[model samples]
Target: MVGTQHAARILVASNRGPVSYALGDDGELTSRRGGGGLVSGLSAIGPDAEAVWVCAALSDGDREAVRRGVGEDGVRMIAVERPVFEAAYNGIANSVLWFVHHLLYQTPLEPVFDEDFRGQWASYQAYNAAFADALAQEADRGAAVVVQDYHLSLVPAMLRERRPDLRIGHFTHTPWAPPDYFRLLPDDVAEEVLGGILGADRAGFLTRRWADAFAACCQTLLGATVTTTPAGPEVTWRGRTTRLGVHGLGADGDFLRERAHRPDVAERITALRAETGAGRKLIVRVDRTELSKNIVRGLLAYRQLLTDRPEWRERVVHVAFAYPSRQDLPLYRDYTAEVARLAAAINEEYGTPGWDPVLLKVDDDFARSLAAYRLADVALVNPIRDGMNLVAKEVPVVSDHGVALVLSREAGAHAELGDDAISVNPYDIRATAAALHTALTLPDADRAARTKRLADASTALPPSRWFLEQLRELQG
Candidate 1:
């Protein structure tokens, strides 16, 4: 039975929380805070507000914590049955929603929606229902509930049915698929996902383009009526109107600056500075080897730049940090291998006795990434699609020498920083190569000026303020 407590509380539901725990050999539980915009934003909300972070247990440590019954910092950890969790998280959310929105899958040979997919869809629902039940159990009467990302799309509707008094908001940290692509989901699932989101009092996207795409999907698929308002886009369906909003998540400048100056970062900077050599311009890109990240394409573009412009042969070095991501998935593993192979080919094609043209590292090192960001003369972030690529924002904020950004038009960051960045079509190898050249050659004064504006835009809604703003809007 759901009881309505009169006190208002802030409830944040996401696939992962601000902190994760580790179990040591001594059976002691150690905790560390996680990074990202959400964690920053939640930390910014200040200490006065009563809040609870609801997250899923993704690892053995997390499962242990869940079984023991609470996250380190009072977060509620839910452990759905393993098979169900994997099918929902890996099957539907990552495979279906992520691919459809990013336009990653090869439509002809993939996306076979068979009995296996149907079973996964059922698991996805069960996963979401588990979250909804947990959230409903925790939320106070008339509490402000903010759900995060595609992993929990169905939670809004499920929770709304249980707690109508709660002010619900859903924020997508990824691009919403256009109606045609979104309809690729079985008709019933498509309707339910849209209907689930529409159950919220407010649904927020990283950009107006994404918000509009979502509204279009609702209009086309569910025949929901959408109207423009000063507040934002409003969708009315089945006598309930859900307000849509464009809320871009930005970098935490204060935190980054402090972290960038740490001892580890200082050591990394000295090491990278030597690797870059003297008098050579450094073009850097730090990305996990996610298919949507377009790491291989970015490497190819760099190769094309070397091929087309011979003068830059020994003068520029492309320092690429291609960290591994989702290695459990065959597609991701293959993509990472391809990134490595292409990078090696570039080195073989362009390496001189003194200069290795492409220095590619697959290790995950935050200090090294920041060191590269500071040294970057040109920062390349060419993703096929992104909710908001924070690297695009973080580089400008930390660059010691003014860094010119070569951004992907497909990234959500483009809406905020594209005017200053040399924008390129993610699919156009030649165009991306050209943009990199332009970024590398921009006047120092121009680069500095753009860096300032870009930094301002990137930090406009720092984590704490971004979270608080949503809470205000939902309550208002």
Candidate 2:
């Protein structure tokens, strides 16, 4: 959607790029394009639009490619030393920023910020500086640079210092912790984060609640002046005013439909269809095994449903795909093991020779996930807190037979889909179980109507338009 002349001036900086290269047995590097909102947004800009994707080298293959100067034509990758990258990525970005934003750390004993954390914090800054330098070097004069997610939160401020003529925008794809919880971060680090983000002309969040949370952090922590206006929330610090904007990134309906119809997806659908017996309803949940996903609670709620509503037993199947994530972190590994353990216990308790109560798959398969979306009768997305649970939006848009959504009130998707979904408190297993029962029993007519409305709202702003809208705001 970018204008022809302006397209060349647009640059996207993020932790990962649209494409990655892998070396094959024959010694040829193969390029593979990624999927998801970020990739879709970049692709929507049109192939001829002279855009560049700046990203960090994630794998040894990527680093080798960087060394060989063999990258996807449009991507510029920054390859830091392995130790530095690991500490910056796992130690700070994932362990600290991700946990803080999601409020996952327990206040009683965790997040010990000692000498070790300070060392990692320095690496985090160096890692961010690498990105800032890459983006600044590649971007054209007066370019519009959009930095994404918590990984590169410092890039906006760093890039601003080097390229003042460029229009900079930073978007957070995670929930912003409230002021009190955010104060858990060391005072200096918290202030630095606020100052880094405020360096941009515009700071964007997935929901207004999160945007307000960021504004409150600036006011309380930095003692910065905050003012609300029709334009947007403005934070003034040391004479510079940065606007805060909310943009809920929506599902790409056309892309999902097209991909859902692929041959591999059809094959997966046939395999899943065999698992789903006749006369049984399907309950589908797809998620990465992230701590904030509350996967264990969702499993507990499903178990509760079977216990409380025994009539639905053997009449319904819970198809959950918990793709592995952050396995390097001990906490995530233990959490994943717990998820497997719970699913096993549930199967042992209620599964029959003819019908298994739960079918849990931990492998990553996009085609299988899409197949589940198409056939889901009920879609469960009960994250404790989420920026925007795209699975909540994706299921409604792709459901062949209408799906009843059991959504979490804390999810950003609830802002748009709450009216249609059976909402529940994420912490209440009983309430979630009740909502699941309500979703499964809803009349087909009402379910269809609600699904239609949800599909409309979820697809309200496709990736192309979402990117363009934010670009317009930053440019303004």
Candidate 3:
């Protein structure tokens, strides 16, 4: 910023940036932080890096707030502005792409990709175009521009056509469904999505399975030459060779340690423990209300446990923090309502005056989540499918008391943490319930050993190192 070359200027285009500008209770504009792998990884880049993240502003107030924030160190925080943002993110990103990647589409008899879908597709394009314009404006020649997730899939091509001199990279943090499932998208949308990504100088996915699926799509659909390996893919497009690599993301152990001991978090943990009563063992889960979370099944599993092993009912609690995600999407709203109904049913059947069966929270509070992590005796993470579920790794490393994990085989973390968990199929409520019972009843020595193993694996890579690894590939 002070007359130095800042490495050509790093530009990041995503659906939402790390910080959100909203009105605080005191009538002052306040900036709230973002959780998840992105915030940690981007923060690692620090202020000196030539980075400017451009994301959509969800409201008129948010756009005004972002316009003010855009002054920080040449940080061009551009918001694409309303209605389109909601339709693209909640509608196409979550309802369409997310469902496709997780295989969550309701395929009773046939798949639907009709005119309404095409209208939503147009909104998706407009949203991507907004980010593309921002990047092209901020990025210099040879600058590295990294676009994230399914929300901005079209940005790579939109920007590349305008600024071919810049280096672009795309990383998908979710599964890339098999070609058969993926082909359900209309021909025009399918071609544009693939071509947009192929516009990058490099691309990344979590596992080899997802990476291979991407390469196959390019081969079959785009007729591109692709060479694949265990962790990377090579694709040739328009006579330029773009690279692909996999870097398994890890939890920030130090940050967790620091936050876990924060004064506010300690207070929250005390209240939660006291409110739940003295002898209850806590099983904690923090997730957005996504279809792939399998929240309803998890609730059923808990019910099965209370019914099958009634003795544990009086002593165990599932403290679930499920935030509202993609609420504008009817399917997600329906899923949230369904989860609420299930929670109510279980409480009606099992609650006592002193104890509610499930302590459910439907809001976002990162500090409270960390507090729950510290208080957990058992952590439940059972995603039906995931690119990588970091909760399985993070909870073990951050918990103040050592904790056993009940994990699903479908989670990408299963490959690393399976040895330390009581593994179960996410679909099988009976088996998951049995596993939960077993975890709570695990002997102290066995629990301690498994907890130690899980903790060790959880912090294997820090966020700074994760981002550096990806850039190392790009630089080389």
Please tell me which predicted candidate would have the highest lDDT against the true structure: 2
| C-alpha RMSD of each candidate structure in angstroms | 2.0, 2.7, 2.9
Clashes of each: 2, 0, 0
Q: Which candidate do you rate higher for lDDT, 1 or 3?
A: 1
lDDT of 1 by residue, 288-328 (tens): 89899998889889999998988899999999999998898
Residue-level lDDT of model 3, residues 362-391, one tens digit each, is 989888999998888899999999888888
Candidate 2 RMSD to the correct structure: 2.7
Displacement of the residue 348 alpha carbon in candidate 3, Å: 1.5
Q: Model 2 Cα displacement at 269 (Å)?
A: 2.1
Instruction: Give lDDT per model, in order.
Output: 0.89, 0.90, 0.81
Native-to-model Cα distance after best TM-score fit, residue 143 in candidate 2, in Å: 1.0
Q: List the candidate 2 regions with Cα displacement exceeding 4 Å.
A: 1-8
